[model samples]
Target: MQGLIISALIAIGVIVLLGMTIRIVPQRNVYVVERLGKYRTSLEAGMHILMPFIDKVAYKHSLKEIVRDVPRQSCITKDNIEVSIDGVMYLQVIDPKSASYGVDDYVMAAQQLAQTTLRSVIGKIDLDKTFEERSEINMEVVQAVDEAAQPWGVKVLRYEVADINLPASIKDAMEKQVRAERERRAVVAESEGDRQAAINRSEGDRQAAINRSEGEKQEMINISEGEKMKQINEAEGRARQIELIAQATATGLREVATAVKEDGGEEAVSLRIAEQYVSAFEKLAKESTTLLLPSNLSDVGGTVAGLQKVLKTIDRTQP
Candidate 1:
């Protein structure tokens, strides 16, 4: 029984020794080691050995990326608007020794730095820009934090703004402003439409008036042309009638002259003349006019003398 008890004790001591001397680090993990309470080396993936109690794991760090939530904080914008801002950050431990010894807590340092940087960036812009320029705010925070966190063995990959909470009064005022702007645009558009419609109607009326005037002008021109044609036709008819009358008178005169040239033409013409003189006197006396008798009315020689005087008067009157 004493020999069995000593063997069990030796086995227990060996297991404890093994546990103190060996370390199995998982993949993408780093184990910081300290010798006599001083940083010695970093143990990586797989198995490692330590020098008994002289070396011990101080800090454990992951090589993979880490996500940390940035605490919500109140920030004032350039416009003096207070807003609540919160975000998230992506980071990774690049150097285990620096991460362990460089800072008390890399995650806290990075998060605090991110918050302060966000506040500074937000203060530089207005509240309206805070909502619109989220990406810029995030980038500024990431760049500033990453630069500051380099000493802590942390690589800040990305920063994202999660939410921006505006005050209720500001939201309501913005809604009212947007609605008024829309209403103003609608009124302006309606007025423009009415003005265009009025312009179109005026143009239509002007065109119609022009068309009517042109029609009237054309009608007047047509009437003038018709009147000119009618006047020309009537004048031509009157000219033709005058020419016919002159021709008829010339033909009658020619017939009379031919009859005068026949046998006994001179004595018949003298006797016909005497009869025309007697007939013209008789018609004149019938109108209650005075008539004077010739002293040689019974003599043929005196009558011939008087007929010769009448022929001279007729010849003087002809063209």
Candidate 2:
């Protein structure tokens, strides 16, 4: 009976020891087990058994993705401008054994490396580009840190730059510059509009002036043509009057010549010639001009006597 009880107690002790040695880790979790202070194999999730006294679980890390934020750090840019930068890193443990033994603190190491990498990257770019090229800088940082951390069994999944802080004075200067640029553009646009309007107005005025001038010129031309036509008509009328008077005078001269030629004696022709001479002398006397008589009083007296006889005959034939 004593031996059976001792054996039963030993069995119970062995079962308890076995129970303590078996570990059931959850999914996505890894246990870095060590044997006698030396690194053993990493224990994966679900039903991992180890030597209770010889082997110990050193560190447990989740295989799931973890996020850590890099604190804001002051950095100088390529333009010698100072700025503050912050970022976040997504990481996962690829190898729990190496993550346990490779570095003292993988989280601290990754954060420091991220900060330094961020500073170095920011230093190569201007302050304006630091914010604009944040994605590119994130890619560069992830690549660099991922490469460096490969031996440590850490995988960097993604990196993101959260914010970039500029100095208040720099922000103020940028705002002023933007405002000035807008004002300059507005003024230029306004001036261009005004100039175009003025040009249009001037063009309209020029056309109007041209039209007015053309109208005035045409009016003056019409008036000048009318005056010319009036003067031509007056001159034509005077010419016609002179032509009619000349025709009448020519007819009267023909009648006088016919009458003189039809006279039957030289005495009648002499009388007619004396009457024409007397009429011309009477017209000359009206103008008060002196005439010298010929030195033949007998011939003049004979002409007067012939004219008197022709007058007496013409009076007897009158109806």
Candidate 3:
């Protein structure tokens, strides 16, 4: 009975020792081992054997990337404006041993460092630039924190400013400024439209005036041309009438000359001259209401002789 109990106790002790010696670490995780309260080695993701009661896992660190939120804090800009800012930081533990021993708390240190760097970056620029240069500020924070975290086995990949809070007064002022600028632009646009409309109206008036002047000029030209044509036609008609009158007078004179050469022409001409002389005396007596007599009223033959001589001279001169 005593020997059976001793074998059973040995088997139970062996099982407890094996259970204490063997360790299995998960993937992407590192275990920092310490021997007798001093850091010995860092165990990777695999099965590890350690002497029982001698080696212990001091710290466990994940190699995976982590995201940490930086607490919101108030900062003053170069333009003397107070603004609240907050961000997120991407970090990874590169060395488990250093991460465990180099710093009291690397995560808290990184967060505090990021806050300080962000404040510093914000203080260097004005309020307007703070809103516009957020990426630059984030990059600067990452650079500053990453440099400071080297000994702590923390790698800061990047930083991003998540939110920026501005005062209500400042927001209202900005809105007013934008509204005023828009109103000024609208006024300028309306003025430009009015100016363009005035120019168009003036141009139209000028064109219309020109067209009216052209029409007037054309009308004057037509009138003048018509007057010239009328004058020419009148002159031509006058000339044609004068020509017809001259031709009728010439034909009458020719017929009289031909009749004078016909039978008994001398007797007929002498009688006609005597009759014209008597008719002239009668007309003078009636118009003057006085007695008018020839120097020799009985010398009718002498007057006839004078008229025949005048007629003979005319016939010789006419062709």
Candidate 4:
């Protein structure tokens, strides 16, 4: 019975010793070891053995990336506006020993540093810029926090500003300003459209007037041309009629001269002349109030004889 109890105690002791000496670290995790209360070395992934009761794992750190939320804080901008800001930070531990000993708590330290850096960056710019320059502010915060966390074995990969809250009154005022600007632009655009329409109408009227004037000018030219042609035709017709009358008169006169050259033509002409003289005197007596007498009024034969003598002389002179 005593030997069995002793064996049982020894087995228990061996189990406890093995459990304390051997460690199985998971992937992406590291263990910080301390021997005799002093940091010995860091254990990587896989199995590790330590001197039992002397070497102990002091700290466990994960090498994977970490995300931390930054608490909201009030920041005053260059324009003296108070705004609330919050963000998230990405970080990773590169050195286990430094991460364990360099700072009390790296995650907390990084969060506080990020807040301070964000405020500093915000205070350098206007409130309006705070909303527009979020990326720039985030970049600045990451740079500053990463630099300060270098000794703590924390690498700040990036910082993102999650939210920026503004006053309700300011939002309302901005809305009003934007609405008024849009309305003014609309009015200007409408006026521009009207102006262009008026210009188009005027241009149309001008073109129409030009076309009408051209048509009128063409019509007048056509009318004048037609009138000119008509006048030319009438003149030509009258000239032809006058030429025919003159030719007929010439032919009649030639026939009369030929008859005068024929035998007994002189006697016929003298009798005709006497008859025309008497007819002329009778017409003169009726048309006048007073009777007009020829030089040989009492002797009509003497007048006839003088006319015959003048005719004979004209016939002798003709070729």
Report the error of model 4 at residue 123, Å. 1.0
TM-score against native, each model: 0.62, 0.57, 0.61, 0.66
The global Cα lDDT (0 to 1) of model 4 is: 0.92
Ranking by lDDT: 4, 3, 1, 2
Clashing pairs in 4: none
**Clash pairs (backbone) in predicted model 2:** none
TM-score of decoy 3: 0.61
lDDT of 2 by residue, 88-124 (tens): 9999999888888899989889999999988899889
lDDT of 1 by residue, 1-319 (tens): 9999999999999999999999999999999999999989999999999989899999999999999999999999999999998999999999999999899999999999999999999999998888788888888998999999999999999999998888899889999999999999999999999999999999999999999999999999999999999999999999999999999987775565555557875567678777877787788789766877677657755676676566546545555
Please tell me which model should have the higher lDDT, number 2 or number 3.
3
Give the clash total for candidate 4: 0
| Collision count for each candidate, in order | 0, 0, 0, 0
For model 3, what is the C-alpha lDDT against the true structure?
0.92
Q: How accurate is candidate 1 locally (lDDT)?
A: 0.90
**Model 4, residue 86: C-alpha shift (Å):** 0.7
Clashes of 3: 0
The runs of at least 3 residues in candidate 3 whose Cα sits more than 4 Å from the true structure, single-residue gaps closed, are 1-16, 193-319
RMSD, one per candidate, in order: 7.5, 10.4, 7.2, 6.2
